[model samples]
Target: MKSLLTAITTTVLLSACAHHDDVRPGNDNQHYVVIKSVDRSEGIKEALGQATHYCEQSQSNMVVLNETIDYKGELPEHDYLKTRATAEFVTEAGSWLWIIGDGHVDDVAAVAAVAGAGKLHSMGAPYFVTVNFRCT
Candidate 1:
């Protein structure tokens, strides 16, 4: 019983930490893109945001094509936590957005790291959410 409780606690802590994978473009489809989220809601949120950005860039509209959520058991060791930087540089967001820090990219995550509040992911969230969307 003790061992079972320990395992459950470990799982809970791990799931509490959510990370975003880089935006992936769909193969053979120029308008399609994939947003991967370690957590489901966050990933779907990213997909919508990405599609929105694409539409605004091309003066088009965003239409979500499909969404798939899957659990592939244990994922390989991934250091998804954002590493804060002692030094930083950020550009204004309007036509473009830029947030720079250690172990960071100038993407949606950067924005989240800088401005603070993003989604509130609780313990034991879904494993993964893969969102496929199109910018039309």
Candidate 2:
């Protein structure tokens, strides 16, 4: 039973892991790497490890140049669509819905709630981080 659980867990973890891109040389003696992982910090850590290895191979030290983190996972199904619809309604209806009437205000309130929910839920999505480093 333990072995079966372990196997299933390993398979799920492997499937969740994103394909790692090899470190490549960029302009001006800098190196670039892109890594995606189930967790954000893990992706950044992996990039640092690759950069460290690269610098070690050249008998130099690693210096981080720049980095950008991005989200690579889709929001839960219709979450995106729901957010868009809410935003569109507000843009089309304008503030009059909230200033004069209370019914549209409820609709806007629901829209706000749904939009915020999507954002919160998306916080757990997969992370993609790009790191730039120089061997000095």
Candidate 3:
């Protein structure tokens, strides 16, 4: 019985880790951004700020139309907890703008390692922010 219990516990833990590995902020063909901080809330705050900056930079007359937030997981210490924010805007030229900000409390070292790999914009210790913008 004890061995069976151990096996079950191990399976659960492994599955949880796998789920964390699969966590991603945005989808392909859309702007992707990532922000990591000491806490989930702070990370989300930073991500949103970056997203707004991106939108503003795109066009001076851009107007934010809608925003949505999604919480991806539980537990901050394990780097599983994530907060994602999506905002839609309309530019002066009547083009649609889409921005996505993903925030999480993840390993600082790991986050830094991927800095500037592709769309990664910035990375500073506990906080990292990535932004993508599409206009049509």
Candidate 4:
């Protein structure tokens, strides 16, 4: 009985620390792009720039749908929890509208990355980026 209780407690704790899925489905015209880096702020900045470039190429206005930052390492030891901070980065939205709008690229992910990058800016931490977009 004691072991069973321990197992249940452990399971609960692990689940609590796990990362949540941040992805959301856009319209049928939506697309997604993703980027990851060890530098948080820089990663976001790069993502935003990429998004802007895509918008320029497609002549579409930039619209950010979502942004998130997540921890990339294992749960810290109890003693280290106070002193250790997990590396983090952001993922912006990704959408397909850019590619379809531009009529120059068939890569949906690539186009979405542009907007994702544009939506982000460097935080000087390790991170990732995801961009989503859709046309009205």
Candidate 5:
């Protein structure tokens, strides 16, 4: 009986831990970005607030990051746009977005790095932008 209880407790704990991963401040479904440094960037809270406002106004929650972001896989178009918009707004608002994932380029820094560096790499999807913005 004791062993059974222990097993159940462990299972419950593991499940809870997994659930908590999603609750992390930057790991949620929000778009991830990787700003180059922390020196001149606004923190996440201010960016999140503005993002929430933009989302509320646009009826679309496009969460963005100010830096490079890597994700496990390719994000869908709508999700990407929403995340990108959020990232752009926050970056413009003086916040920096850092990457929260590790598989693919999902953050602005990464995109900017690639685009600026003139590297031709694709993560199974074509990302094309006619206009580009440079940040100091």
Candidate 6:
């Protein structure tokens, strides 16, 4: 009886392994763009716009968002940045991309690495985009 149980267990384990092998791999490296926000203003808008323009070169791109934020009315010292401009994205490579138009901003590094891949271009102060990516 113990021998029969061992045989059944081995067969089940092998079957599970075979099933796992059947699972196909995915092309996670598929390129896409996260628009985040599209503004025509000098701040955040310009930076985001440049990213949008640059991302257009990619055939398989995804626009993250197409909206604008107004931070003028909010208090500068307050945590208005948390709500005013926010974006989240993922890439196969370990990096962050960030684009901003407002000179008054925080967490620029995290944003740039995830979005810009550390390649940042400034249209002006507070108007810049940083790229982060990896080809898989």
Report clashes for each candidate as comma-separated counts.
Answer: 0, 0, 1, 35, 16, 24
How accurate locally, in lDDT, is each candidate?
0.50, 0.70, 0.39, 0.48, 0.39, 0.36
Candidate 2 vs candidate 4: the lDDT winner is: 2
Query: Cα deviation of 31 in candidate 5 (Å)?
Result: 37
Q: Answer with 4 or 6, whichever has the higher TM-score.
A: 4
lDDT of 4 by residue, 23-71 (tens): 3335664644455664456656655555555554557665666556554
Per-candidate TM-scores read 0.38, 0.48, 0.28, 0.38, 0.20, 0.20
RMSD of each: 18.4, 11.4, 21.3, 22.0, 19.2, 19.0
Candidate 2 on 1-136: residue-level lDDT in tens?
9999999999999855533345888788888888766456777888888888777777999999898888655765356456545655554454444455577676785565566555545545356788899999
- Cα error, residue 93 of model 5, in Å, equals 0.5
Q: Model 5, poorest ten-residue lDDT window? A: 127-136
| Candidate 4 Cα outliers beyond 4 Å, as residue runs | 1-27, 74-126, 134-136
Off by over 4 Å in 3: 1-29, 60-136
Q: Per-residue alpha-carbon lDDT of model 6 for 20-97, expressed as tens digits?
A: 221122255432222222232544444344444444444434243333443333235243333224322222122322
- Residues 1-136, candidate 5, lDDT per residue (tens digit)? 9999999999999875442121223324443322211112332343344444434443664544443222333576566556555554544432222354344434655565445333212222223211111211
Q: Model 2, poorest ten-residue lDDT window?
A: 90-99
Candidate 1 regions off by >4 Å?
1-30, 75-126
In TM-score terms, which candidate is top?
2
Candidate 1, residue 116: Cα displacement in angstroms equals 20
Order of the predicted models by TM-score, top scorer first: 2, 1, 4, 3, 6, 5
Point out the higher-scoring one by lDDT: 2 or 3: 2
Q: Which candidate leads the pack in lDDT?
A: 2
